[model samples]
Target: MTRKIGTEEAIKRWNRFADAYAANHTELGDIHKEVFLNPAIFSLIDTVKNKRVLDAGCGEGYFSRLLAKAGAAVTAVDYSPRMIDIAKERTPDDLPIEYRHGNCEDLNMLEDKSFDLIISNMVMQDLADYEKAFQEMHRLLTDRGCFIFSILHPCFITPESGWEKSKDGKKLHWNVDQYFYEGTYEQKLGERENMLFFHRTLTSYMNTLMKTGFMLEGIIEPKPSEEMLKKYPSFEEDFRCPDFIVFKLKKR
Candidate 1:
């Protein structure tokens, strides 16, 4: 879980995990599908329906396919070409979704005022230049357009503090206190081209958003379900610590 995020490492790991990541969720494991398509985020107003939408850092176009299904002019972009190819293959014939191979930070390929809604789903954590990405989203959005995005909640959630079953059939807790070490890390693989999420403080996130000309509209803190609590007893820890956070934003 304490692996590095980068283009070199992620290009291969994501390719290897692309099939699985598409089939299942990488962070929430399909339990919280609403993280990407929540009513409060995408459907809060009259934006998605028949509106030109941009899904930046779209991995395999899951939300892009959903937006297309909802009658939106969708243009999905990702940093990985392999991801774009897979996304193109997965979209339905009449979805009207256009998958483009582009970096999230530099969306110069898209003209100004090209989309009504620009969505970046759980991908902000994977980018190093989010300030530039925010600037590009502002440039791409219509005069009153919005950019809704989701990311790993940095303040409370740490990737290394996860629980997995050991061979001895005992539940062991990992005490990985790597928060002090805020630097790039690579995966077990030899590649190192992906962007490992550098967790900034919550104040940092909000300040950055305000500095980038975006107004925070709504926030979604999704919790595990009752079934999940019954199935996995350890999930109740979220009562004290939440896991995921979805945010809604508009051009300021």
Candidate 2:
């Protein structure tokens, strides 16, 4: 459990990033592509030809639109009104897509067993109640429906332990002192606004999904492409840490 961030505060924090978030990805272009193709998300999209899909934490609806373009009937949902607005704008009007404003913890507004596939990227750490969210996911999925998601890898990404390492000796290093302690981590994006996340153990995460009735399918940790490495000088060093993890689970 963690300190609860009210819906209002959560909404406000994401609103700050809404306008620039897509542009940031656009700016990162190849960099963004590399991250998306990262291990976690890749293994889950085996075949998305014609399925009902939901982008659960669709920050900007980028993946949601991608799935729709790939022939899936897609619905993208986000708690932030600002995010939903941006998602709607980016989505093509002709696509069979819906952008809804809703929290992950309670998908009560949506019909049960309505989705065939669900995808969420970088959403786990942002949630205030993962259990409730997982339960909703289970309820929303039809029998054997697939739920795929990604998050910051708990094993490697610990804050302030230093996001830096050396070329020799310890291939992996961390600040043990800072690693164990947990608190509200705030990244000051502006004078009045900030980015937030919650940190938890890997075991905690696996258990939650299992209890919610998902059979863990796979876990992936991706590396940058050689071409990307040649272009970005710091890619090798900066990407040593597993930045993200994807989980594929079948609803049972």
Candidate 3:
């Protein structure tokens, strides 16, 4: 049986893996972010000039810097202290971003109705108690405020899902299993770190967001654009299966 771990353990693992994880991220974030998530996220976002934005679970703060450059008043938060440190280090002094060490599930340091937009990119599946995190996001946003987030697609990236490659290392179809299992599972980030992830069904995610008073506005299962494909032709296989899902929600 897979052991169930809590949020604290998850954050600890992130702290330990912070350096390796941040190493891969550039100003545009990692390759995955550059190719898939960033396009989908920025497309969903409205004009951010002079708007207040909160980057929940803002890893090493790359997105925060991007938002600030786009003229948003950005407050970025991460549960891992090491991540926050790296984010602060990477951020330029000219960029006006407030980096805080806090969990998305419980951000009492931030006041209510404090932001115009809240973005949690590639973060929802990392921590347990996503319902609480959703509630906290709703609480932090003003009425009609937008919340955008992305995650590994629940329909495809399950705990036991990967490519079903044939012999001789030929390309093959993707494999997904344990879609109903809702708990903690570990996956390796680098050679040494076995990162923890929380899995939930698609229905659970949508219903919980609705219950948290968010009206779903848009969703994108990002595919590499022609430009991206030209840069990374390997992403052409992304047409076969979606690796990530992005959502845009409005506070109601």
Tell me, by lDDT, which candidate is best.
3
lDDT by residue (125-189, candidate 1, tens digit) is 66656677778888898887888887766655553545455899665543434554443443232
Identify the candidate with maximal TM-score.
3
Q: Write the per-residue lDDT of candidate 2 for residues 84-165, one digit (tens) a residue.
A: 8887887778888888999898878899999998887777677767788889999999999999888766666654544335
Better of 1 and 3 by lDDT: 3
Deviation (Å) of 72 in candidate 2: 0.6
lDDT of 3 by residue, 1-252 (tens): 164698899898899999999999999999999999999999998799999999999999999999999999999999999999999999999998999999999999999999999999988898799999999999999999999999999999999998888898877899999999999898878677788889999999999999999999999999999999999999989999999999999999
- List the pairs of residues colliding in candidate 3: none
Looking at model 1, residue 151 earns an lDDT score of 74
Instruction: Please report the TM-score between candidate 2 and the true structure.
Output: 0.86
List TM-scores for all candidates, in order.
Answer: 0.77, 0.86, 0.98
Instruction: Predict model 3's lDDT versus the native.
Output: 0.94
In order, the Cα lDDT scores of the candidates are: 0.69, 0.74, 0.94
lDDT of 2: 0.74
TM-score (C-alpha) between model 3 and the true structure = 0.98
State how far residue 216 of model 1 sits from its true place (Å).
Answer: 1.2
Better TM-score candidate (1, 2): 2
